[model samples]
Target: MQVLMRPWGAMHYRIDGPEDGLPVVFANSLGTDLRLWDAVLPLLPGIRAIRYDKRGHGLSDSGGPVSIADLAEDAAALIEATGGPAVFVGLSIGGMIGQALAARRPELLRALVLSNTAPRMGAPEIWAARIAAVRAGGVASIADAVMERWFAPPFRTTPALHPWRNMLARCDAQGYIAACEAIAAADLTEAAASLRLPALVIAGDQDGSSPPDLVRGTADLIPGADFHVIPGAGHLPCVETPAAWAALLAPFLQDHAR
Candidate 1:
């Protein structure tokens, strides 16, 4: 349970593997914490895996107002603190952060992995409606809908689904809304297009939030980005099908390890 005290607030983070191993920084999705990568980390050995609870998530502080750039700055500071020029893997809004980070501080990253996300997630109207719902009834009000988008039908029926639902329900509403505000205002299409680095774009075939075509389109934006789709998975493939996710990620990590 390590914490980095940033100028804004405290950030909860953890580092695994050897001190001198290749650094792989993982930025989690909107509602999930560092534990989002728990199942995927063990599958890829011999590398330092750095994961943190983003502002407004997990044990991190919920500061007032945030944007993709603000989140990217936090990521940059974390990477510098832990030592960087590492491979960065980001999911959902984390992917958006990766886009912003690569554009802002290209030297901080060796490669980029964008998973189940897009440069622009949803329309402002849609985010506004979601914000209204959360304000009206809290995150629990949308937990069921979020779960459906997060997991495939088969996984939804299993008891394993309950914990994830609870995770979403228990998240700070103010933080959740702040993230929604960031997502609403973010449109990284131009930044993603200008990127010139080793990049991999991944999508869960059944991802309702960022569909395969949308994720693939993001891949197309970057020059020479490898794109792949994980079958039978939803928004969070690394969580839903970690082995398959690691199989795709291990080789990328190997190729770019510094």
Candidate 2:
């Protein structure tokens, strides 16, 4: 239950593994917090894994307005605080933050992993409507739809779905809206293309939000980034099938170990 007091607000974060191990910073998706990587972290032991809730998500304090770059700054501060120059793993909007951070402060990262995300998500109109809907009806209004996009059919019928659904519905309305706003305004195509570091891009075959082709396209943007697809999963493969996700990630982390 560690909290980093930033200039804007307080950020909830945690560090796992030994102090001298390689650092791996994880940033979760739009409606999820640091716990998003809980299952995956245990599988990849012996590394200093850092996870944090972005402003407007989880236990982090909400602010007025923000962009992808602003969110990246928060990540940068976290990495620096933890003795940085580490590998960065991000999903959904978190991936966008990774791109912005790589472009803005390349020295803070040793490698980059973009999971189930793209340079730009939906158009402004789509996010605008989502924001309006949440403002009018709260996060529960969109929880079902989000759940549909988040998990594949099989996982949807299991008991695991309920907790994720509740996590989405319980998200802070203003915080969720603020994240939507950031995603709407973000366009990191060029930043992703210009990245010059060890990188890996992954996607779920059934990811409705960021499909395999879209995520593969982001991989194409990077010079030599390897792209792989996780079967029987949706947007959050690390959640739906953590073992398979870790199987892919473990090697990448080994290859880029500092």
The candidate scoring highest on lDDT is: 1
Tens-digit lDDT track for model 2 on 21-82? 88999999999988899889889988899999998889999976888999999999999898
List, residue by residue over 17-130, the lDDT tens digit for candidate 1. 999999999999988888899899999999999999999999999986899999999999999999988899999999999999999999999999999988999899999999
Between which residue pairs do clashes occur in model 2? Answer: none
Per-model lDDT: 0.94, 0.93
- RMSD vs true structure, all candidates: 0.7, 0.7
User: Each candidate's TM vs. the true structure?
Assistant: 0.99, 0.99
Model 1 lDDT, residue 138, Cα: 98
| Candidate 2 lDDT for residue 41 | 89
